[model samples]
Target: MGRNEFTVAFAGNPNVGKSTVFNNLTGLNQHTGNWSGKTVSNAFGCMSYKNITYTLVDLPGTYSLLSGSKEEAVARDYLCFQSPDMVVAVVDATCIERNLNLVLQILEITSRVIVCVNLLDEAQKKSISVDLKELSRRLGVPVVGSSARSGRGMSELKEMIYNMTVNERKTYVDKIIYSPEIEEEAEKIFEKIRQKCKSDRIARFLSLRLLENDEEFNKSLEKSIGISVEAGVHKKEYKDMIAEEIIKTAERIFLSAVSFKNSEYNKRDRKIDRILTSKSTGIPIMLLLFGVIFWITIVGANYPSQWLSSLFESVNQFVRDTLTNIGTDNMLVSVICDGILKTTFWVISVMLPPMAIFFPLFTILEDFGYLPRIAFNLDKYFKRSGTHGKQALTMCMGFGCNACGVTGCRIIDSPKERLIAIITNALVPCNGRFPSLITLISIFFSASLVFPFNSILSALLLLSVIVLSVFATLGLSKLLSSTVLKSERSSFTLELPPYRAPQIGRVIVHSVKDRIIFVLWRAVAVAVPAGLIIWLLANIYIGDSSLLNYFTSSIDGFARIFGLDGVILAAFILGFPANEIVMPIMIMAYTSNSSLMEYDSLTQLHALFTTNGWTVVTAICVLIFFLFHFPCSTTCITIYKETKSIKWTMLAFILPTILGLTACFLISNISRLIFMLAG
Candidate 1:
C-alpha cells in the first residue's frame, strides 16, 4: 500500500518468454526454460519505472483459466481471487493465435489488461508479422510488442504499465459473445454471482466458468458466492459450446491482426524433429547423446578431482600443524582437520567437477528444446505400460534430483499416474548418485583399459545402468498400475517448443548458480555431521573392537549373501542422509582410521578395495545396490510431502530396497554356485 508501489501480474502460455520478460523488467536472474511446467508457482519481483514501483508477479504457464493441472490451478486462483492492480498477458508473437486463447480468458476476468507480444525477434526471423496496433484495436486492450531475450520493447512495456497502474485510465476488451443458449445459461449464473460480488467482471467470468461444468471451480464459486450451483445436461452442452465459440473468436482476431509470409516458418524445426523424434532414430540418438555427456564429465572431472584432493590435503596438513604450534589438544586437531575437513573436501572434490560439467550441458539441451522430444519419443512405452505419458518428463527430472522429480509430478493431471511417477522416480540415479556410479564403473570395469578409452567405457557402462534403471521404472509402474494404484491410463499432450540457440552466458550463470552450487551445498550440509558421526564410531571402543568394527561385523553375514561385506553395507546405511558421503564413509571403515581419508587416485582406491576382499562379484553387487537402494533422506521427505500418505512413502522406500536386494542376492548366489562347479 505504499504510494509508489503497484502490483502487476504476468500471465502467459508456456514457453512464450514470459519469465524472460519478467527478468528483463526486474533485473533479476530467473532461469528461463524452453518447456512447460518450469513455473510451477508464482514468482514476484520488484521493478522501478520512473518514479513508480511495479511488483511483477510471474504466474505459472497455463493454456487457459479452466485449470487442468496443479500449476494451472495456481495461476487461475491467484488471478481470480488476488486481483492484482493490473495484469500483463504475455503472448508469443510467433504463435499469437494460439497464445491469444489465454489472453482472451484473462481479459474476461479483468478490465485492466495489457497484452505483451513477446518473442518478436523470432516472429520477424520467421517472416511473420503482428500488427500490434491492429491487434490492440481488435482486442480493445493496449498491446506492446517485445522480444524479451534481446531486451527489446521492455521500455515501452514498462512505460505502459506505469501509465496504466499509476494513472487512472479507461480500458475495454471486445466481448467474446458465446452461443445464444450458452449465454442465456451464463446470464442466470451471473445473476446469482452478481448479487454477492462487488464487481460485475468476476460475476460475468464466474458465470461462464460455472456454465463450463468445471466442478472444481464451481466448488470455489459456491464458497465465494454463498450458493451451490450444480451442473445439468444443458450446462454440459454449454461447456462444449463456449469453448468452440472462444476458438472461433480467437481465429477471427488472429486473422485480422496477424499475417505470415511463407507460412512455413517452422520447417527447419520440423526437419530436426523428424530425426530427433522418429521412433527408429530417436531412442538410439538419445542414448548416444547422454553417453557422450557422461564421457565428457568423466574424462573432464578426473584431473580436477585429484588436484582438489591434493590441494585439500595440503591445507589440512597446514591447519593441523598450525593447531599443534598453538598447543591445541590433539583430539581437537584430529576432529577439525581429519574428521570434518577430510569428509567435506572429499565430497566437494568428487562432486563439483562432474556437476560443473554436467549441469551446463544439460541446461544447453533444455534450452535448445530437446528434452521434451525425449519425453515425446518415450511416450508410447509409457502408454503401453498403463501409465500417463507425462511420467516420462518427471523421469527425466529424476536424473537431476529425485526430490525435484517428485515435485514435478504435479504436471501429471491424473493422481494415480503422478503417484506412480513419484514412487519409481528414485530408480533413476540422481546427481547425488552419479559420482558413486561413475566411480564404481571406472574402477571395477573400465579401469582395466588405458587413459581415454577407460572413460569411454565408463560412459558406455553408465548408459547401460541408466537403461536398466529406466526399465525398472517402467516395470514397477506397470506393477503398481495393475495392483496398488490401479487406474485407466490417462492421455497427456506434450508441447515441443521451438528450438532456439541457448544464450551461452545465461547457461553458464544458471547452471553454476542453480544446479551445481545448490546440489553441492546440500552435500556439504550432510557431509559435515556425517563426518563427525563417522569419526566417533571409528574411535570409540566396544570391548576388544571399535564401534565401527562391531557395526560392520554384525552385518558381515547378511552382506555376504549379497556378495558385499559388512563394511559396504554399513557405509550405505550411514550414507542415508546423502549419497555423496557413501564412498568417504566406506573408505574410513576400510582404513580403520579415526578420521575420513581420500585415496589420491582410482588405482589407490582400487588397491584399498582389494585389501578389504573386494572382487568382481562384490563390485557388481555394490553397483546394483547403489542404483536401486532407497532414496536419500531429502527425496524420501519430498515423497512424503507430495503424497501426504505414510503408506505410499513407506512403499516407495521398501519397493526399491526389495528390488535391489533381490537382484544382489541372486547375482551373489549364482556366482557362488558357478565357482563351486568350477572348483
Candidate 2:
C-alpha cells in the first residue's frame, strides 16, 4: 500500500504565531506529549482534508537550521531523517528576507516544501508587499499567504500539502554555489560522501554540513551510528577543513542573495533596531518599554483585582453568617470559608489580571520583531559572560517565570553557557511578584496621585526594579563566568525581523488560555493547601496564642532586625510553590489578626500595616527580598529534573538564597547606618 497518511510539519522562527497556526489547523484534537526517546516535548495532531488524513507535527521553533543548538538539531533531524512527506515552512511575512533564509535552507533539504507566508494581515498593515508568485518562482516552491490568527488560507495550505504528498514530484530548488576554491573543496567532500551514503539527499546535506564543521551534528551522528567520526580517517580534522569551505561558500552566497539596504519594507524595522540596539538608546528604550508594560499591568489590574478581592470577601462573609445562622461549628465554618475558598479567590483576583494584560502585550512586542533586537542589544554583555547573546531572550522569559526561562536556555549552544543562563534565570521579577510590587507602589508612592499619573508612577517604579534586575543579572553573570562555570564565549548571530502589528484576537486567546489560566490554575492548586495550613497555624491555640501568633512572636525580634515581621517571612517561605500566593498569604495573616472577613479600602490596608509597626524600611525590605528570593517550586523541580542531581539542584536553590539574603541584609543595614549618621 502506498503511504496513505502523510506527515506535515510546521517550521518557523519563534513568536511568529507558529503555535497559533498549529492550533487553528488542528483545533481541540491536538495532543502534546513526550517524545519516545527524549525529554523534549512532541506535539501531534490530525486534520482530514479531501478524505485523506494529514498528521501535523509542530517542530520546535528555531531561528536557523544550522544545528548549533539542541532545538535546531531537533528540527534539522526531523526534516532529514523523518523525511516528512511535506514541509510547511512558515515564514513571518513581515520579515521576508531573514525568514526567507529558513525557507531557502529547507528548500535545500527537501523539495516538497510549502512556503507559508503567515501574518499577512500584519505584513499588509506594515505596507510590506510580498509578491507570492515572484517569491515562489524564485524559490521554486508553492507559496501561500496565511493569517494564522484569522484562519485565512488554511484550506489552501492543506490542499497544497495534499497535492504535494500525492504527486511525489520533488522540486530541487537551488543550492547557492560558493567561490571556486571553496566550491572545489565542497565538491571534493560531496563526491566522497556520495560514494559512502546511499541517500543522495542525505549525502549532499551531510557533505555540506560536514564541510561546515557543525560539531553538534557530528556528535549526533556519532551517537546514532556507534562510531566516532574522529576515529576514522581523522574525520574531525577533515570535517574542520570542510566546515571552513562550507562557511566561506555560504558567506559568499548569503552576501550575494541578501542586501541590507534601507528599503521601505524594512525601513521601520531597521530604524527601530538601530535605536533599540544602539549603545545609548537601547538601554533607555528597554527601560521605557519595561516601565510602560508594568504601569499598564499595575493600573489596569487594580480595579479588577479590588473587585475580585471584594467579591471573594463578600462570599466569605456570607458563608460565615449563613453558617452561624445554620448553627454549624464556628471553627469548621471558618476553616471552609476563610481557608480554602477565600485563598483561591484572592489568587484569582490579584494574579490573573496582570498576567492577562502582560502576557499578550509582551507577546505582541515579540510578534512585532522587537524581542530579537533585545537579544541583539544585549548580546555583547552576554557574550562577555561566555554565553550566547540570545541568553538575554531566556532572561526575558524569566520575567514571566523562572521555569520557562530555564527551559528557554536550550536556545543557547554551549553547555557551560546554557547552565549559567539557567542558574541565573530566577533573578528577574516574574508576574508572580508583580502584585506585591504594585501594592508597595500604590501604597507608598502613588497614594498622592489621581487618575493617569498614579498608574504611571507605579509603572515607573516597577520598571526601575526590572532595570535594576538586569544589572544584577549582568553582574552575577560576569562573576559566574569568571569564577565557577568558565568557558569560551559563544557569540550570537541574531536576525532582526521586520516589525509588524500584532493580531489582537490571537494575542488575547493565547494570553487568556495559555498564560493567565494556566498560571492561575497552578496558583490556586498550591494556594488551597497553603491557605489551610495558614488557617490551622493561625487558629489552633498554643500557650495563650494561636500557633501562627506564637511562631511570629518568637521570630518577631529576628524579623525586626531585617525590618520584616515573622508572618511576612513565613509567607515567603510558604510561597515557594508559586510566588503569586505570597501577597494573599500575607493578607490572610493580617485579616486573621482581627478575624475580619472584609476591609474598607486601601487606607484600611495601610492602617493595618501601620498599626503593626510597618515602617517604610519594612516595605522596602519586603520588596527587595521578594525581588531576590529563591526559585519557585516549578523551577526547583525543573532544576532537579534537568540536572538529575540533587547537588546541582540544591546549588541552584542555595546560591540564590545566600546572595538574596546577603544583598537584602547589606542594603537594610546600610540604610540604617545612613539614617543614624544623618541623625
Model 2 Cα lDDT, one tens digit per residue, 345-391: 77777678778888777877766667777777777777666667777
Candidate with best TM-score: 1
For model 2, the run of ten residues with the poorest summed lDDT = 30-39
What TM-score would each prediction reach against the true structure? 0.94, 0.83
Q: Which candidate is the best by lDDT?
A: 1
Which residue pairs clash within candidate 1? none
Global lDDT of each candidate: 0.85, 0.72
Model 1 accuracy (lDDT, Cα): 0.85
Q: Write model 1 residue lDDT over 156-251, tens digit each, in one string.
A: 998889888877556867678887877777787777668776478877887788777677776776665564666322445777777877878899
Clashes of 1: 0
Error of 1 at 183 (Å): 2.5
